[model samples]
Target: MIHNKKEFNLGIALLVLFFIVLFAMFQPLFDGHNAMAYLDNLYNSISKGSAHYVDALKEEAKTLAGYNVKVTMNMEDEAQAADSVALITAAGGTASAQGKALTINGDYVAILNACLNDADKLYNNDSAALKAKYPALAGKDDRQAVYNWYKILGGFDKELKKQEAFAQAKVAFNVNSKVVETAYNYYKVVPEQIKNKIGIVIFSLVFYVIYTMWYGFAILFVFEGWGLKISGH
Candidate 1:
């Protein structure tokens, strides 16, 4: 009775320990998923919010470009000959500002895309096509001067596409960064090193259990050779 009681208690203790270990192993996996999901949503919201600002910048650039063109056309009229020089100067200023805004905004989008490991190759190819269509703008040191309302209005569809692509890339980059950072932080505890250690420990315990059973069988055989009979009821 005593021997059987001891064996029963040992088995119960091992079963409890097994459950505890299993919980420890799976808890992190479950929690990590939750953390990742939350972070992804957060970054997606941020990207969506920032998209408005990018759109605003693009609109401002287009507006200034349009104003500059209007002023330039007005300056060409004989009725405005007396103020032509002043209008020309104003148009030049607007062009310079518009160019700077477009360049800065485009670069900002490109940098964000690069962060996400995306090169925005389609945008580059399309921009190249635009440049090809307007060779004058491509060759001029002052692209703003050549990218007047006439040129942009002539290819408004392509210009709009380029703007949309830039905005998309920027948002994608922000979202990707959030996902990466969240995963990195959440999985730190259950990293490869910890998993490897757990695997080794499990294998060692399995080996120990097998070896112990083999040794017990060998002892039983020796006892039988000595004319001892071991029986179980």
Candidate 2:
């Protein structure tokens, strides 16, 4: 009986230690009373930044379109006819460039939507829905599904940054032109802080799972050890 009591006390102590370690590991996730708040903030930042960037591109396109119309309307002015024609041609090229930017932005938005959808599915623990929605992930298990979703999000952010850099470079090369300069000035990229936050969010997500698994195994060990002690007694 004394041995059994000692074993039970040890089990309780082990369980307490397990919880302490688990809590320490997941402290970041527990902040603000929302385990996934960092992830949500990261997603929101990306979505809002991308939307604003796309809108700015559209506005730049509209500006060039207007310039094209103006140049065309003033083509009859003999003194400025050559200059007008040149401006019109430049405007057409700039407008085409902006259109391409918009197309790229659309692609980014699509990827972002997929990321958000996957996140929702993960949050709801709807593994079946995730598999159904993403046929490529149909065969993956639950943990794998979560990892794949995270990978997709990380890839999307990387691609978005690359595309943004390319767009910015395009605008910079044409900075001598007023319209291009205006577009360049209006270009908004994801902030560095948000990018760092994404890393933190991903880390927290992965650690959350790891810590939970550890805690479960610790509990199992404690119970098994206590059972052995009781049988011995």
Candidate 3:
């Protein structure tokens, strides 16, 4: 009977250990408060709706800077006329080289079109070209600069659609892709924490079961000793 109990206990411990390892492996997914939170983060990230916009905006600003369009816009009108004239001289008006070459694609549709149409013309990394053109980044290795703005734009749109379908957000915001993506990333950590909790729980339960079995065996041994003494008396 003791042997049977021991075998049963061992089997339980092994099963518990197996499940604990499995949970640990997949813990990050369930580290949040609930499954819904996990789904929300996953959908946002996989679809690239939440973070892509920030990346796109950053890239677009860099691309514009490459064209020598002054990033710091003068707020005061005191310099307006002079600035306008300078702009005309540097870039020209509507038909100027600045206007034609300095493309602004805030929307994913427009960005994608520009990328597709000017694939050969556009550099994958603007910092290199910009440095070569401007001589400012000549010494610095601006390797972090990526010209994959168009790809990011597409990814953001697709991820946004997924986040909307998941209904994680209160309502689908028509704002830029990066804004939503930022929100999604901010909340993603919740799921990871939850998964860790599950791993801990599984490990605890297994140890508790093992402890209980050992305790039961110790009690049985004590009882058998008492029976032997009584028979001898």
Candidate 4:
């Protein structure tokens, strides 16, 4: 009867050991979906925020372009006037009185002010200023020099808008790349590492349990053998 009880106890222990090993080996498999969900959320948040920031930066660049045009035109005319004055001063009244050159103060002043006010409008984001500035260049094409200046200013504005668009595209592309990279690292790489570590731990415990079970069986078998011999069975 005692020998039967020992065999039943050993069987029960082996069954328990099998269940424990299986549970340990596969526990983390259930967490797979959960980890993926978190990674998706992180990707969405980063990508959305980055897109918004890029749009805002592009708008700012466009505004800066408009503002720069006005400032540059005004400064250029001012420099030309200063150069004329410097020449007159250096040569005394003789240079000014020379029939070889002339400076039209009225036209230059009008154009210079027009450019300055337009630039200020861009800075202030005033639509009214844009409307007011464009018409100032109309029909007064008599000042061919000033008209050329206006053309240059217009070209610069167009280039600036192009730059803004380019910048926006660059920012969006970089943001997307970063988000994808982060998701890949977290979900694919990090989870793989976690799974490996857990597998190692489970395997170690399984072997330990197997060893214990073997020792238990060996001990029981030896004791039974001794009893049988003592009883002369």
- Locate the minimum summed-lDDT window of 10 residues in model 3: 166-175
- What's the TM-score of each model vs. the native? 0.20, 0.30, 0.21, 0.18
Ranking the candidates on lDDT from highest down gives 2, 4, 3, 1
Which should have the higher TM-score, number 2 or number 3? 2
lDDT, candidate 3, 90-169, per-residue tens: 22322112321322223333333333322212222234443354242245434211122222333334454554432211
The sequence of per-residue lDDT tens digits that candidate 2 reaches over residues 162-233 is: 555444333222221322222222223232344656677678779879767766766655666556433554
Q: Where does candidate 4 stray beyond 4 Å? A: 1-3, 29-233
Which wins on lDDT, candidate 3 or candidate 4?
4
- Which portions of model 1 miss their true places by more than 4 Å? 1-104, 113-233
TM-score of model 3 relative to the true fold? 0.21
Error of 1 at 129 (Å): 38
Best by lDDT: 2
Q: Which candidate is the best by TM-score?
A: 2
Residue-by-residue lDDT tens digits, candidate 1, 46-136: 3433322333334333322222112111222232233222212332322212211221122322223222221121111233433454344
In model 3, which regions exceed 4 Å deviation? 1-126, 139-233
lDDT of 4 by residue, 13-84 (tens): 665675676565444443554433544444444443332232343343343232212112122344333333
Q: How many angstroms is residue 160 displaced in model 3 relative to the true structure, after the best TM-score fit?
A: 30
Model 4 residue 168 CA deviation in Å: 44
Q: What ordering of candidates by TM-score runs from best to worst? A: 2, 3, 1, 4
